[model samples]
Target: MNIVFVMIPIAILFVIIAGVVFFWAIRSEQFEDLDRQGSNILFDEDLPAHQPNKHTDHDPQP
Candidate 1:
C-alpha cells in the first residue's frame, strides 16, 4: 500500500527518538542506584513506633 511509505519513516523516527532518550538517561545517571532506591522504601531509617512521644496522651490542667 502507498501508506507504507509514510509509516516506515514514522517508525524510523520513533526508533531514533527512543535511542536518544535511552542514551540521555544513561549519561545523566538515571540508571544508577536502582536497587538502593527501591530498598530505601522497604527499610525504615527511623522507627517512630519505638520512640517515646514528647507529649503524653492526657494533658494536666493548666
Candidate 2:
C-alpha cells in the first residue's frame, strides 16, 4: 500500500516524458513521409526470382 506513493509519481513522470517526446517528434516533421510509405507499396516491381544453378545433370569430370 505504501508503494503506491512511489509508483504514482513514477507513472506521472513516464506520462510526461512520453508526451514531451511525442510533441518533439511531431514538431520535427517525423510524420511527413507517412503518406508516401502507404503509397509506395502499391507500385509494380520487376524483380526476378532467385534460384541456384542446375549443373548436376551436366558432367564436367567425365
Candidate 3:
C-alpha cells in the first residue's frame, strides 16, 4: 500500500538513531558506576543529631 513507502523509511531511521545513541552511551562513562549507587542504599551513614536554639532565650513553643 502507499503507507509502506513512508513507514519503512521511518522505521529504518529510528533504528539507526537508536544504534547511534547506544554506542554513544558506551563510549561515554555512563555505565561505569553500575554497582556503587545500588550498594550505597543498603548501608546506613552516621549523621549528627539536629541541635536547636543554642544561643537564644526564645524557646520554640509547640
Candidate 4:
C-alpha cells in the first residue's frame, strides 16, 4: 500500500515526459522521411578499389 504512493507519481511523471518528447518529435519533423534512409541502402553507389599501374613493362625500372 505504501509503494503505491511513490509508484503512481513516478508513472505519471514518466507518461508526461514521454508525451512531451513525442510532441517535440512531431513538431521537428523527425518522422517526415522514414523511408528515405531505408531505401538509400538499396540504391547507394559503391566505389571501385584503386589498382596499381599495369603498363610498367615499357617504363624503366627503379
Report every candidate's CA lDDT. Answer: 0.88, 0.86, 0.88, 0.91
Report the number of the highest-TM-score candidate.
4
Q: Tell me the tens digit of each residue's lDDT in model 1 across 1-62.
A: 99999999999999999999999999999998789988888896675676545686555689
lDDT at 38 for candidate 3?
93
- Candidate 2 segments whose C-alpha is farther than 4 A from its true place: 42-49, 53-62
Q: Candidates sorted by lDDT, descending order?
A: 4, 1, 3, 2
lDDT of 2 by residue, 1-62 (tens): 99999999999999999999999999999987898878777874666665656775555765
For all predicted structures, in order, the TM-scores are: 0.66, 0.62, 0.60, 0.66
Show how many residue pairs clash in every candidate, following the order shown: 0, 0, 0, 0
Tens-place lDDT digits, model 4, residues 1-62 = 99999999999999999999999999999999999999999887895666657785356779
Tens digit per residue, CA lDDT, model 3, 1-62: 99999999999999999999999999997899999989987785776566666678467779
- For the record, the alpha-carbon RMSD of candidate 1 to the native fold, in angstroms, is 5.9
TM-score ranking, high to low: 4, 1, 2, 3
Worst 10 residues of 4 by lDDT: 49-58
TM-score of 1: 0.66
